[model samples]
Target: MSDQPPYTWWPAGLRRAGAALGVLGVQWYNAARTNIGATATSTVFEPFVTTALAGAAYARPFVRFAGTGTWTLGRAHFAVGDRSAELLAGASPPGEGTYGYTVTRYTNEAHKGNGLYRDLTLELVEVTNAAG
Candidate 1:
């Protein structure tokens, strides 16, 4: 009963808000990911490592393969400044075992930098539980 386009049927404010939220989330992910996505590019490949700890003391370590000798995170480790490579406890709801994940490395030649954000599919992979 409306002549307006299907896409325009939604409220303008709602659409804008959704897009804004999406962008904000991206920025946050990049910030957190910077911790590991820093050495994305260099003559010698630098292995980016990330350890997951519930608290502070003893904890399990999770290693990630950043890039190869030819392709590194040197200039492409900026796209995920705030993105978090590890999944929070809340996100997993407490678990253990080997998990699978897909790490997405972001790159930007214009900014002269690059970034990466990993997305875990299998979820939690608890190797050893430390009573710390």
Candidate 2:
């Protein structure tokens, strides 16, 4: 390993940069055998912006999270958009009590946003069935 000096984006800088992207975000749980992680069971979320899928716009809902670092994978999740007005947790929104999307795919997207994209883009697709 070559000796080098640490710079801004080494660690703390990343967290600071992440704050800017914390405009609209999503919250979810790990939904795994080991119910342990960043926000262990109560409620955890990450900064993200929802986008309409390019071609399959209606069919697919696209969400963009951090470009890099600490990605928690879970079967179930809740999305609260609309200026954090609507909240749906685990296949149900408020009184609905049952209805959500299954995470079919989680992808890492790369584009010319190192300055803005931070690290990369995270794309998640939801399925018909409920996930949790």
Candidate 3:
């Protein structure tokens, strides 16, 4: 018999669900920007799935950044939710639009036994202008 824990398959299952339902993407930054135009030293383009917060209006769009692994974050720029956008260091974030979002809050779910995070959910709020 295998010595692996029964929960070992959980991460793969979650990843599959994310791939199927994750139509949105966000530019994840390793450091917090003091303002919108500030330069980011490091960034990664990651795909994500979005949902409305419970008991919240549609205007307040919420997205969750789920992965089979852990991540470090300081700020995120989500404009248009376009999975095709190329995010580069020093490049400005996308312009304001219907789905433009800013990370307002986040919660991390990590495995206590292994200290590996399984999910990182970022709560997003809509951006109304380019100054965000």
For each candidate, what is the lDDT? 0.23, 0.28, 0.34
* Every candidate's CA RMSD: 20.4, 17.1, 16.5
| Clashing residue pairs in candidate 3 (N, C-alpha, C atoms within 3 angstroms) | none
lDDT of 2: 0.28
Candidate 1 — which residues are off by over 4 angstroms?
Answer: 1-44, 56-120, 123-132
Instruction: Give the winner by lDDT: 1 or 2.
Output: 2
Kindly state the number of residue pairs that clash in model 1.
26
Instruction: Order the candidates by TM-score, highest first.
Output: 3, 2, 1
Point to the candidate with the largest lDDT. Answer: 3
lDDT of 3 by residue, 7-94 (tens): 1001122333433222232222222321122112111234233322223221211233433444333334443443222433234445
Please write out the lDDT profile of model 1 over residues 23-102, one tens digit for every residue. 11111112233322111112112212232222222111122333322222221121111222322111221122334434
- The numbered model that scores best in TM-score is 3
In angstroms, the error of model 3 at 35 is: 35
